[model samples]
Target: MTQSATWDYIRGSDKDGYAIAIATNNTVYESREVDPATALGLTFRHAFSLSDNLLLRSSLSAVHDQTWSRRSDALIWRERLDYDIGPLRLFTSVDTKVTTLNERNIFALGSFLPYPESFVTLSVLPGVLYRLSFGEIGVSLTASRTMFRFETDYLGLRRNNDRVQPNLFASATFWGIKVEGSLSYARVTFPAGDFDNLQRLLYTAKATIPLELFRLPIEKLTLELSSGRTLEDTTLPFSVINVSTLSDARLVAKFNPSHALTVFARRKDDEYVGLGARAVTTSLGAEYAYTFDGGLTAIVAGSWRYTQETGNIPVSSLNLQLGLSKRIDFSRTTTADASRATPAAPTTTR
Candidate 1:
């Protein structure tokens, strides 16, 4: 048996546009199969308005974990600067991270075994956005580099590997429809002479559409479709390149027949690629909720899913759930009362 506990604390200052968060997680194992572990994480973020047209923001995080025979530590930091001029905005950001893993125990049956490893990553992104009459369009370019090292006892040395990636992304929204796309290329090099260099390419695209029903109980409908593909090429002599494709699509509709009753339905499809294989899954789900006075609410949900894969038997499953919840409002003002008392913000004027 195992037990775990977690605690989180966050403090933010709206006047200064700064925030800090800290979290701790501890787990203990009772059985002989596993060991206990504890992890602590902290994050700090701040934003500064340099001028009426310029803004700067930065964030940093650190995490440390100690397990039976393994210890892990990581640190990440990012900074961004943005400047806006009329309908156009320009921004640039840099992110960097380092992670280290160490292991103390080497020989144990069914025990935690860790390999000493170190990883470092750095990324830079620059982008520009232009506001249109109806919506907005943005384009960004990213360059990233990562290095990984592993200590080997046999060679009494550490093996090094590195990868470099360059990516381009674009997004736009117009006429109640949103579209986003990205393309990335990566080159990986190994210095340990165990494997040859490799190259990989990835492409992804997504689109979202929202619809409103005027005369029906249905309030809104949202449809989303996305697809991605990855291609890999090896640098070894006479090595063949391989390509994998994945797709995901989902649709959701919401209905409110009465003030106290709400209903929703969703359909989703997902495709995953494996080694020379592909698997697909389709699911449909519906949920209904009813709220009564005295903070009582009841919900009923159902879902059905089907999965298919090459050279495997097709599988299907159905699930149904019922739940009830009670709300205890400790505040003197209710949500509706608060909304009525607070005035809306004024709109911007040109």
Candidate 2:
């Protein structure tokens, strides 16, 4: 899954040149009849700086598909605010969202199928935020309560949990480069033995150089490099603690060499860096997009992923897909993937 920290600072600005369109495809090759599908989307956004101290934003989107169409059409909405009171100002947001599907009908990175019967999760998190900054120092805090539900994949019973937790973060920016990270501690008490508790801890670090920071017209062309790891309750039998590390390398560059073509590329590499003799599995992927002046767009992309077992047995999946799209601009576009844009603006999604 894509992380939520990427677009926290992008408050929209008003202008005429703010329309966008996108399309995507997924094809899995495993010597079997895997379902294939494509997605198309569009977006428009404008920003108001509100005197450099207060900001407000909103966006809406809809998603429909022929692949796993049974899942449901996705609808998403969001809003955010940032007001500078002095050294610190309070921030807040409201959001509505639904899961979209990948090739195997799965919604995230860890699996390839929908959650089994009786296994479910649904909730909305409204949060309050505080920011602190001075010279080279910066810090932020968000307290949110999640009203969530869960169930077993094999059983037919549902369970729910209501909890509040604080998300703490600290960062520093220097020499046109900024380093940031955050920590979260969650406690879920279920009364029932098997439904009881778990802990998830994560750490992330990112470094980027904005082309504009160095005075370039391409605002989307930024050099970004980052990595993160997670520790969680172990489900492995006889293991003391369960830890998995995913290291990523990503580069997002936007090229508008002329008004006729909008060129972009996204490359990512991640692997299971679990601790063991043969635990270094990896996957690498890249997508190249070309958007014509007439609003027709095409894409060609591919990926390869390999896994090595404890005994060093290796298995892999190789894939390639091509897609075509025609945006009516009149048809409503789903906002699910629009998270690729700031929550305040609709853009391409995961």
Candidate 3:
């Protein structure tokens, strides 16, 4: 069983050219196979609009996890800058994370071994886009490096790893059908150790089609299909759970019968390179949400899924969940109102 809560507060509006936000998330988990655990996260974000066409945003986050009678912590920082001209836009971002793990004994089994006691990873991406009549085309280059030190030899792992990749992507919409595709080449270098330098090419394409385009009665139904390896997220949350690191091809369909309800079905084929395993999963789910007069919102969701994996027995399961979310603005005053209320400086002595 797990219980979670989140609080978020914002002090200003992006339209005002400056804003700040603070948020916290806490979760408690109980399990029969493992000891109880608690996880806490705190984040701060700021946005500055230097000009109408220029923007700068930054965020800092810290996460602490208490489990197995040990505490693990991670700190992350990210910064981004963007500027645009008449038909061109340029942007750059930097992300960094430092993590300290103390759970080596917890995973004594065959589970993928955890990282070194401490590690740091940094990545930078800079890209440019050209707005086209139908959509846009862009190119981006990403470079990242990881460094770590281990007290004892665990898996013959090295202390240094680096990767560089350049990607080309484009998206366009035609007759109610939207399509997108990207191609990238990645080169990775590892210090003389357990692994050798390697290179690979990656590609992904997706398309979304609405039933209305075919004059079908179900105007709210839409289908989407995609295949490819997405960019990796280097955040603490994802890193802790070791999720979303697989490449998959997926097909999904969604239908909305009402303003507050939605239904969806999905099928995905996953490829786990590290484990040399492949799996297929299918699921159906629905979600409903309603807001009260006092601004509080309640949400309920449920799903049933089945999975088949190589060298493992097929399994199926059902899940139900409930959650609550709300956003509060501490600064109710608008920029224009604040400016007007500042009674013009006392008129110069006549």
| Top-TM-score structure, candidate number | 3
Cα-based lDDT at residue 236, candidate 2: 22
Compose the digit string of candidate 3's lDDT tens values, residues 65-122: 7654355788999998989998899999999988776543324463324653677889
Kindly state the number of residue pairs that clash in model 3.
0
TM-score of each: 0.55, 0.53, 0.69
Quote the lDDT for 92 in model 2: 66
Between candidates 1 and 2, which one is better according to TM-score? 1
Q: Write the per-residue lDDT of candidate 1 for residues 1-350, one digit (tens) a residue.
A: 11222222323332236666555555555445656577777788877788988988899999888876557788999999989999999999999989776554224343434444566777798888887775566767666665565444322433344656566666788788998888878666656644456676778888988766444566766777888866432111122123556565656454542223223333333222122444466666655556565535455555666877556699776655554544332224567876775322111100
Question: Could you give candidate 2's per-residue lDDT for residues 1-350 as a string of tens digits?
Answer: 11110111222233111333333434444445544443434333433466667776555556554342223345556666667676665666665655333222223333333442221223344434444452223333333222223433223322333333345565666677666766656444444433434455656666765556555555466566666655322112122123455555556566552211122222222221223322455667765566666554555556666766555467776656454544443222357645353222222333
lDDT of 2 at 26: 47
**Clashing pairs in model 3, backbone N/Cα/C closer than 3 A:** none
TM-score of 1: 0.55
- Provide the clashing-pair count of each candidate structure: 0, 7, 0
Task: Write the candidate numbers in order of decreasing lDDT.
Answer: 3, 1, 2
